[model samples]
Target: MRRSLIGGVLLAIALYLGAGTLLFAFQRSLLYFPQPRAIGGPDRLLMLPVTDQQIAVTVRPLASSKALIYFGGNAEDVSRSLPDFAEAFPDHALYLLHYRGFGDSTGRPTEAAILHDALKLFDKVSALHSEVAVVGRSLGSGVAIHLASQRRVARLVLVTPYNSILELAQRQFPIFPVRWMLQDKYESWRYVPAIAVPTLLIVAERDEVIPRWSSEKLFAQFRSGVARREVIVGAGHNDIGGRPEYLSLIRSGI
Candidate 1:
């Protein structure tokens, strides 16, 4: 009987180690959900040349000094938002990025790659427009915050933001050592203190993906009076864009 008990313990340990190995190997697959571009044509798309890869940006061209750059959620098709943004901000030119591996962009999505692409896009846009506002939603919030820390953004908006992707992963996979294995930490709080531009955080009252506490934690990281938080009543993580006040709040922010 003691032999059987020892054997069972050994089996459990082996299984746990195997699971950890698999988690570490394929962790990025769980983080990025690449989606195809649903809208835009050759005329409306801008092919941005990066290091050995051409990134696609859905653009609304307007000859203006004010511009808006948008980063989207993991599974979002950023092209879909172009029409609404064009109508709302007629005076401002719009550029919405398709992350690496999403839409027509090439290369795989990673924390470093996405942040690098964001900086490239910002530098290109800021060169054309004197003032630029940045908006990011969900996973893209981390990318946006990091870019804002490194750039000179005129205004900033984050929707359904979180303190860090690592925290979320740790909460979801409590059995795994996520802190040690996570390749893309995306610690937005680390960049929030560096943001000197006016910022707005749009939160969903009933966000199921990112907990309200996580968003509040990120908000608290901002220097006092540098950012404001707005909650959309009866909104969830995925459906907050459908809320009546969503675009209006964004308009106010940028």
Candidate 2:
């Protein structure tokens, strides 16, 4: 009986260790759902230097002094956003980033790599434009929050944003130690206090991914008078773009 009990204990420990190893190895893979280069036609795609490889950006370039830089969701194809943006902001040049591995961009996706690329992209846009507005949705909210805190962003908009990927992950995988396993924490709450630009946070009325409280908590972290949080009546995490109020809020913020 003693040996059987000892064997069961050992087996449980081994299973736990194995699960942890797998979680650590493929954490980023679980987070990033990369899609193929969907923005067809040669003219729509633009390449920019990021490390050694040319990162793909969906550009709606105009000879305008104002530009808008959009960082999409983790699994988003930014090419789809071009039409809506062009209709809304005709005078502003539009740049939508496809993260490494998401489109034609090379290398694997990582938080450090995406943040590095965002900084480079923002610098390039800033050189030619006077006022640059930034929009980040879902996962991109983390990138946008970080960029707005570091750079001179004119206006900031986040759709279905979270306080941090860490907190969200912890809630999703309650049995696991997500805080220890996660490689990309994406703690937007940390960046909120330093952000000085006028900000708009659009929340889904029924967000099935990011909990409403998580966004509210992040909104609360913003310096006293810097941000306004609005809710879209009938939208979820992915479908918030379809809401007319969502676009209106974005237009007003810009």
Candidate 3:
């Protein structure tokens, strides 16, 4: 009986180590769900040369000094939001990025790579526009926060934001050491204190993916009076964008 118990303990340890190994091997596949662009044409597309890859930007060009640059969720195709944004902000030029692997962009998505691309996009947009505002949703919120911290953004908005992807991963896989394995530990809270621009955080009242506490924790990290939080009643994580007040709140922020 003692031998059987010892054997069981050994098996459990082996299984645990195997699971962690598998998780680390395919972690990026689990985090990013690359989606094809739904709306695109030569007139609406901007090919940004980044390193060896050409990143695609869905654009609505305007001869104006005000512009908006948007970063989207892991599984999102940002081009879909172009119509609504164009209608809402007629005076502003719009640029929506397709992350490294998403849409027509080449290369794989990583936290560092995405942040670098965002900075490059910002530099390009700011060169033409005197005032540039930034918006990020879900996974992209981390990108936006990081960019805002490092750049001169006139206004900022984050939807369904989280304190860190590491915290979320820890909650999901409590049995594993997510902190050690998660390569893209998007810790938005780390950059919040450096954000000097006026910021708005839009939360879904019933966010199924991101816990309310996570978003609230990020909000609390912002310097006092630098950020405002708004909750959309009866909204879920995915459907919050469909809420009537969604674009209006965004409009108010930028």
Candidate 4:
């Protein structure tokens, strides 16, 4: 019986090691990836040069007191939706950020890398535009929240955002030590309460990627007079931005 117990313990150790190795190997897959595109057409995607990296930003001018800066979800090529976004806010200057290692941007993607690049982009935009409103979708929401917490933004919009990535990782990988294993812990929940700008959170009732409750939890923490929450009915994570009602809500909120 002792020998059998020893054998079982060894087998369990082997299994644990193997599982950890596999998770580490495919960590990139856990991130969102999207193809990059330019504004207007494939030939016109402009590259904005930063101190450390060159980011692909789709720019369009709209007539408003504020400028619109959008950050896409994980693995999303923010430049892909530039044309529509440009059309949406034709009068305000629209700036879409390509995260590190995404769409013409340089360097490998990591939590710190993304945040650093985002700060650089913010500084660049802030230098030129006096009033800047930020929008973050899904993974980008974390970036937007962090920026708003630190900087003075005119408005903030989060689509399909969550309380924290750590919470989502825990739910998806209950058996694994996801919180410790994750290198990009975009902890928005800790920063959201500090944001003082007008914040609008758009939650999809039927979002498949991020559950509605997670968004509600984040929304609950916001007690500022400018904070508001809206739900898009029959919309999922990917399609929520395409709906007319969603666009209307965004326009009205801003």
In model 2, where do residues sit more than 4 Å from their true spots? none
| Lowest lDDT 10-residue stretch of candidate 2 | 35-44
Q: Using Cα atoms with residue i matched to residue i, what is each candidate's TM-score against the true structure?
A: 0.99, 0.97, 0.99, 0.91
Better structure of 1 and 4 per TM-score: 1
Model 4 clashing-pair count: 10
lDDT at 13, model 3 = 99
* TM-score of candidate 3 to 2 decimals: 0.99
Cα lDDT of model 3 by residue, 1-254, tens digit: 99999999999999999999999999999999999999969999999999999999999999999999999999999999999999999999999999998899999999999999999999999999999999999999999999999999999999999999999999999999888889999999999999999999999999999999999999999998899999999999999999999999999999
Tens-place lDDT per residue, model 2, 1-254, is 99999999999999988988998898888899987766556787788888687788999878899999999999989888888898999999999999998888888889999999999999999999999999999999999999998999999999899999999888887878888889899999998899999999999989999989999999999988899999998789988898777778998889
User: What is the alpha-carbon lDDT for the whole of candidate 4?
Assistant: 0.81
lDDT of 1 by residue, 34-69 (tens): 999999889889999999999999999989999999
lDDT of 2 at 115: 93
TM-score of decoy 2:
0.97
Q: 161 in model 3: Cα distance from truth in Å?
A: 0.6
